[model samples]
Target: MKNVKARYLFLAATGIAMVACREPATGKEHPPSHHAASITPAKAHNVALYQFAGTPPAMAALIQKGIMTKLKVAVQLMQGQPLPAMSFYKPRNRYIADSLLVYLRGQRPAACEKIIGLTTRDISTRKGEIENWGVLGLGSCPGTACVISSFRGGKGKVSESIFNRRMITLALHELGHTYGLPHCPDPVCLMIDAKGKMNLDEGESYCAKCKNKLLAQGVVTK
Candidate 1:
């Protein structure tokens, strides 16, 4: 009787341990390694950028550099009019990308025509002629166009290792949506959704197939 009782107790302990170690059904319990593709980059007339006053200067600079670099490359590939100059604005408070657009329409109607607001809000809109892109800091978008926000530490906290590899890729990805590009099938491409948790190094600058698509859309020429 003692041996049988001991065996039963051991089995019960093993069952408890298994249950404790089991993975969560909801997936949010663990960090995600991959993100789906949300949007693609094409071409546009002008892209107006809005940043909150609290945003670090370094982050603003990174956004400008990454966006311009990609735009330049897209221009080289396509024959659309050169991207209009990008400008920055200071808002009263952190605004959602869509809300910013509406506010700009009331405040600066002319400026709003070319404006694109960047925020950390979790956005669910698709990319198109009139749609704006949002990129939340370190988050993913279920659909095209996300609201991207910065990490809490400020620009200084974003190291080159983080910016070049992660932030820049995200900028390019969101910008792609503005130009009417859809998510890419390639998991490692910058156009991939990445669910906002991708390692920057895992993205591609531009794939040939994507390039061709841009050309077809009149976003690129050659």
Candidate 2:
């Protein structure tokens, strides 16, 4: 009798332990029907270009206006949507490209799909590359977009009218670079070389080949 009682007690204890192990902690079980659908990847990106100081106020405004106007037109042409808001940042010192990138990361906006930095230095140029030794604006981590910088200066003292015209072309060019575009072969296109020219002549838009390229990238429509 004593042996049977001990055996019964051991069996009961094992059963209790097994039950406890199998049961999940309260509130830990996931809902059976609440699995969320994966978020669709973004096809187009909205970029915010931050301008650091050292650029003249008038020049900055011209750059901003030109970029905004061309970007709007580009979106319309592409049949794509624009970000609800685009912004600029002013830092006390020049070359705040890194700081601006850090700032955008902290904001954590879903709408701000990308961030681009516009500086007076050529990011692709060797000199600017050396200067940006410790910078992080070249690109973001995987699933994030890249950052592109452009240099737009030559003459020491350009007239206001000329600067304004130059701003229009430069803005379009830089924005094009941001959108994964390269310089066009066509001399008349806005994305053509700007070694000495200041602006694009009226009625000159993206060249046929460039337009086809943009269309392929879903950046422009027929």
> Number of clashes in every candidate structure?
23, 0
Q: Model 1 off-target regions past 4 Å?
A: 1-44, 73-114, 119-146, 152-158, 217-222
lDDT of 1 by residue, 1-222 (tens): 223212211113221111011112564554543552353333343444555444455655666667666554311111112111222223322333443333422332221112233433233222344233333431122112223455422346667566545666666665565444456778666776544344456674756676675555443456
What is the alpha-carbon lDDT for the whole of candidate 2? 0.41
Local distance difference test values of all predictions, in order: 0.41, 0.41
Question: Per-residue lDDT for 150-195 in model 2, tens only?
Answer: 3444335676565466545655554554444555667778767544
Shift in Å, residue 72, candidate 1 = 3.3
Clashing pairs in model 2?
A: none
